[model samples]
Target: MTSNAVSIKQIMTTEVLTVHPGDTMEQVHLVFRSSDIHHLPVVDEEGRVVGIISKSDYYSISNAFPLFRPDLRAAANDRLFKSLLVEDVMTRQVATLTPEDSISIAAGYFKENLFHAIPIVDKGGMLVGILTTFDLLNYFFNQEVFLPT
Candidate 1:
């Protein structure tokens, strides 16, 4: 298939790791570490993308109110901020793409929204897979055949 003909479903990472709204920040951090992914689609009981969380989001909340002066040593012991919930720190307004969408379209959305990763949803709006800039990069760079005119 031509590069343009390749769809997101072909390259999207199907193993989706999600978090519930009530999950604590500390719990989410463990998920992040275990999954080895920075973004997690926050889902409701029905598996809809209610929100999204990123490492940057957690760091932003954790560092927003520093207990002490902004010192490297002081910041190392920031475990006190882990009490925050995913709902408190996650971006509720999330941008999502469908699995059938073309890779080019997904790339454009990522570029326009400045998003590193976006959650993929099915027709019912259920979380399916995740597409990242890295995935797209790998698709283009790893392919030996370039699209023909």
Candidate 2:
């Protein structure tokens, strides 16, 4: 089959690292550092995705307020940053994909959007997996066993 025929479920990662709206910024910071991922899906108590957090969002907050350093002007912002929650910074308007969607569809989303990752959810809007550009690249370059002639 051609790449266009390949479904996202075949390439998407079922084991996803997710966060909640109530998670603290510090907790998200540590998760970002530890997961080594660029994006995370924020879910609600019922497991429905409500938002998304990207590494750039964290950088934007830091650059806008400079929370890491103990400089003169940043003191007030630093305190505020520490007290801030993930929901405050995460993008509430998130783009998502379904498991059955084709990889071509996901590629189109990536081409149209500035983000590199897309959250894969079921009909109930519950997070099931994640798909990233890296996953696409792996399919193109490394999944030689399944690539069609």
Candidate 3:
């Protein structure tokens, strides 16, 4: 079969780690480190994706306030870091692709948005899987077995 006939689900990683809106920054950091994934889909209680977070997002927060170090003790008057939350740093507007979506369509979205990964959802907008650039590349370049028609 041609590559176009192959659905994204065939190669996409179905195991996904998600963060809730109320999750703390420290928790998110731990998840990122353990999962070894830069992008995370932020979901609500209903399991619907509400936002996306990236390593860059955490970096941006760190960059904005150099004084807010984990080792540093906050003075009684200091409140800059304590008020920070995931909802404040995560990208509320997220781009998503459906599980049945063609790999070509996902490729185009990646090109247009310059995204490294995209959250895959089902028809009901529930999180299903995740598609990354590496997944597509591996599928396209890997040797496939072919039998006589």
Candidate 4:
């Protein structure tokens, strides 16, 4: 069964914020800090999806700075942010979907994987949107309809 028995385009987020390979961790950090999004699709100059950065990925990488140093932690984190690039840490082997893909297929992807988000791309591999588990929840909760058994 799928959501609304339709394409995930109905629930995917089109106005997605992104980061680039060359971007500093601090730059991406600001975006993560400011937004409620848990995943950021990393795109190239041509807007082609190259990789993805999850909030957990960011935190896990940065957490290497300290175990619990309240004082040195800030400076260490700041240093890491300045030195590391998005490409240096992002997951390069990202799974992507098209806007027209079936919601059931995407739900299956979510069910089978540990990741929570998938970047929506065009036939040419240009990113157009993103779909997350949370988006599916919103669809389930907000829609007046559901796929019948």
**TM-score winner:** 4
Candidates 1 and 3 compared: the better one by TM-score is 1
Give lDDT tens digits, candidate 4, residues 1-149.
Answer: 34537797887999999999999999888999898999999999999999999999889977886675877888888898999999999999999999999888898899999689999999999999999999887777665565554
Worst 10 residues of 3 by lDDT: 73-82
Across 1-149, the per-residue lDDT of candidate 2 in tens digits comes to: 67788999999999888888888776777787788788888999999999999999877765674545558536655565678888998899899999999999999999999679999999999999999999998887766675687
The lDDT, on a scale of 0 to 1, for candidate 3 is 0.79
Quote each prediction's TM-score.
0.84, 0.85, 0.82, 0.91
Give the alpha carbon lDDT tens digit for every residue of 43-105 in model 3.
989899898888888666555655656445233113433466779888988888887778889
Candidate 1: worst-modelled 10 consecutive residues by lDDT: 72-81
lDDT of 3 at 123: 86
Ranking by lDDT: 4, 2, 1, 3
Backbone atom clashes (below 3 Å) for every candidate: 0, 0, 0, 0
TM-score for candidate 2: 0.85
Taking all chains together, the TM-score of candidate 3 against the true structure is: 0.82
